[model samples]
Target: MTPGRLLVTGAAGFIGFHLCRRLLAEGWTVRGIDNLNDYYDPALKRARLSQLEGHPAFTFQHLDIAQRDDLHRLFTGSRFDVVVNLAAQAGVRYSLEHPHSYADSNLLGFVNLLEGCRHQGVDHLLFASSSSVYGANSRLPYSEHDPVDHPVSLYAATKRAGELMAHSYAHLYDIPVTGLRFFTVYGPWGRPDMAYFSFTRKILAGESIPVFNHGQMQRDFTYIDDIVEAVVRLVDHPPQRQVDWPADPATSAAPFRIYNIGNHQPVALLDFIATLEECLGRKAQLELLPMQAGDVLATYAEVNDLAALVDFAPRTPLARGLAEFVRWYRQYYGTA
Candidate 1:
C-alpha cells in the first residue's frame, strides 16, 4: 500500500524522529513538527532533526500542537493520509510538578489533533498511548482488556483521557483510530530521562545510579527498532467498525482499536543494571531507594493483541538493546 502524505507530531522527539526517518526511507513525504521544548535537551532533539533535514522527503516545522490555531493551520494547509501523533508532555514524575504542561499537550493538544483528523478525514490516525495507563491494576501481564480507571499519575490520566477522546472522534466522525500502548520503549537515541539512558550516562561518569523500589521493579522493556516495526506494519491496517463486537474495550462498533506493544518479558531492575554494566565494562554504584510517588511496582505487557493484529512481537532482549544504546551513547557523547 502506498501512502500519499503523512504528518508526524513531536517529530524531533525520540520516537517521532525515528518514525519520521523510517517513513522517509520508505518514500513517504513526511511533514515533521515539534515544539522542541527544553523538557530534556533541545540540542538532542535538534540533532535528531538534523539527520532528517537532509532527506529530500522530509520537511521540518517548529510548532506546538497545543497551539490550536497553528495546528489547525497545518492540518488545513496540508493533506495527510495518516497522522501519527508521538507528541505529548512525557514523564510521570515530572507531571507531578508541571501538571499544566500535561493538560496542555496531552489533553488539549490531543483534542486538537483529533479535531484535525475529524475535519480532514485521514485514512488512519495512530496516537501513542502508554502502558502507564495500567496504574494500580496490579496485574502481571497488562492487557488491553484490563480496565485503566485508576491512573496514579497525571500523565497516565491524560493518556487515558486521550483514548476516550479518540474513541469519541472515531465514533462521531467515523475516523479510523489506533491507540498504541507502548511499554518502556528504549534503544539508541532514546530519551535522556529514561532510566536506561540516564543509567548508562551515570555509570560511564563513575556515579551512583538511583534504583527505585530498592531494585524490585520489573518492566516490559521494549526496543525502539521493535516499536518502529510494529508501527510501520500497523499504518496500513485500519480497524473496521465491529457491529457484532462483544463489548470489547480494545475495539468497538466504531473504527477504533488499541494494542499493547511490548517485549512481554519483564526484566528485574537489578538484572537490567547488571547487563548495562557488562555492556559498558563498568559496574554502577547503586543508590537503592524506596518507591517514589506515581511509580508502579511492575509493568508486564500481554502483546497478544498486537501480535495477532499486526503479526508483531517485540523480540529485542534487554542486554542486546542496552548494548546498542551503550554503543550509540559512547559515540554520541564522545565517551569512548
Candidate 2:
C-alpha cells in the first residue's frame, strides 16, 4: 500500500517511538498519541516525542485512548489509512498493584479503538499483543496457533483480552485486523521497567540486579529495529477473510489474523547477563530470587507463520543489540 496518513498510539513508547520515526522517514503522514503517564518516566516519553517533533509528516497529541469521546473525535477527524494500537498499561509486575490501569488502557481502550475502526471505515487495524499471553504454556517457541487461554499476569490477561476483542470486532464488522505478539523487545530507548534496562542501570551503579527464578529463565530478546521491520512489512498486508478457516487459532473466517514477532531464539538468563557484562565491561551483582508470581520461565517465538506471511526475519544478535543499547545508555545518562 502507498504511504498515507497513519495513527500510532503510544507514540512516545519504546516500540511506538521507533516505529513512528521509521514511518515518518518513509513519507507517511503520522499522528502519534500517548497518555504520557508516569508509569516509568514522563521525561523519557517527552524525549522520544522530541525526536519525532522535527519531522514534518509527524504530529503528536496527548489524548488517552480510554477516553471514548476524545478517541472517537480523533478517529472521525482524521483519515488514517492504517491504525496501529501500541498504547497499553504495560508491565507485568506493575499490573499486580494497578489492575484498574490495565483495564482502562488494555481492555476499555481497545474496545474504543475497535469501535473507532468499525465506524470510521479503517482499511486495516493492527494492535500489539505480547508473548506474555503464552503465560502458562510451557511449549517452546510459542506459536500463534497455540491456545493462549491461561494468562499468569493481569497485564498478560489484558493483552489476550484485547486480541479476543479485536477478533470479535473483525467477525462482527469485517474489519481487517492483525494482532502481534511481541517477545522481549529491547534496544535503545527501551522500557526502563524491563529487566535488561534495569540490569544495565544497576550494573553500571555496582548494585545487585535481581535474577528471578534463580537465574533459570530464558527470553527471546528481540531488537527494537527487528520489531519495527516486522511491523512495517506487515502494515499493508492485512489478512483477508478466510472462507475455509485453517486448523489454527491464529487465523479465522473473519478478516483477522495473529502472528508471533520475535527473534525466534531464546537465550539463557545467565548467558544474557554475561553478554551484558561484555558490553558494559562490568560484572553485575546477581541477586537470585525465587520464582515470582505472574512470571514465566521462558519465552520463545515461533515465527514461521510470520515469515510465510510477511517474510519476517529477525536477525539481530544479542551482543550487538546490547552493545548498541549500552552505547546509547552511556550517552543518554552521561555515564562513563
Candidate 3:
C-alpha cells in the first residue's frame, strides 16, 4: 500500500533522483522539483528526470525553491503529505568561492520550505543536513548530542543555520520535521562535483587526481541505496512533541528530531583509492595536496539513535559500493 502524495525538492539531484524512484516504485505519487541550475551539468539533471518522466506516479517541476511566489503556489496547489528537501548549493570548497549561493539556497530557500510546510500543514518535513556541521568539534563518530557551534565553512554554517531555523518553525507552527545529517553519500549516478566522481573522471583521462590532506582523511561513505531505504522507513514515523524532552540539542519539546544517517564505518582515503583503482583497472596519477580550507580531516557518524528507531543501519561495504559505482560510470560514459 502506498502513502499519500510527496513533494521532493531537488528531485533531479543524485539522492533526490534515487528517492523519487524508490517512492514511485512503492506506489506513492511524487511531485519532484529542481531548478536545473548549471551547478554541474544540466544534462545529468535532465537524464535523472528522464527516468522519472515515464512513471505516471511521478511529476517534475522546474523552479528554484528560493523563489518565494513559486514555492508558495506549489504548496497552495498541492496537499503534500511529505516534503523531502534535498535541494541546495552543495560542495564545501565551492561554498568558499560563492558564499552568496549558500545564502540563496541553504538559507533563503530553506525558509521558503519552512513557510510552505507551516502553511500547508504538512505531516512530515524531511530535509538534508550535513556531517560538516561537526565543524570544529573534535569528536569521533559525531552524534546529534554534540554542540555544533563552530562551522568551518560558509556551507557548513548555512546547513547548521537551516537546522536552527527548522527547529524554530517546528516549535512555533508545530510542524513535524526531521533533519538528516548525511555522511559522504556516494553511488551510481552520483554528483559529478563529488571527489569520487571527479577522481574517476581524471583517472580515466590519465590525469593527476588531487589527493587532498595528503590522503590521510577518512570518511564514512554511505551508499545511496542504504540512505534511500532509511529515509523511506522514517517517513511514516514523524517525531511527536515530548512532554519530558531534555534540554539537550538532540530532541525538543517541539515535534522535531534529528538523525545521523551514515554507514558508520570510516574508510581511509588511500584504501578507498586503492579499491577504486581495482574497480577501474587503472591506477590514478596522484597529486598529494595540503588540506583545503573548510575541509575536515575525518568524518564518522554515530547512528545509534537511527538504529534504535529503525532497527537498520547502512551496511554496504566500501569496496562493493565503489565497484558498483565504477560499473555504472563505465556503462554511462560508454567506455565499457
Please provide TM-scores, in order, for all candidate models, with all chains considered together: 0.99, 0.99, 0.99
lDDT of 1 by residue, 1-336 (tens): 596799999999999988998998888999999999999999999999999999988999999999999999998899999999999999999999999999999999999999999899999999999999999998779999978999999999999999999999999999999999999989988999999999988988899999998999998899999999999989989889997988887888999999988899999999999999999999899999999999999999898878887798777878888889988999999997
Best-fitting candidate, measured by lDDT? 2
Given candidate 1, what's the lDDT at residue 89? 97
Residue 21 local lDDT, model 3: 97
Q: Quote model 3's TM-score.
A: 0.99
Give the C-alpha miss distance for residue 15 in model 1, angstroms. 0.5
Model 2 misplaced regions, further than 4 Å: none
Model 3 off-target regions past 4 Å?
A: none
lDDT of 2 by residue, 76-178 (tens): 8888889999999999999999999999999999999999999988889999999999999988879888898999999999999999999999999989999
* lDDT by residue (tens digit), candidate 3, 199-312: 999999999999998999999999999999999988988989999987878889999999999999999999999999999899989999999999999999999999999887
lDDT of 3 at 13: 98
Task: Name the regions of candidate 1 deviating beyond 4 angstroms.
Answer: none
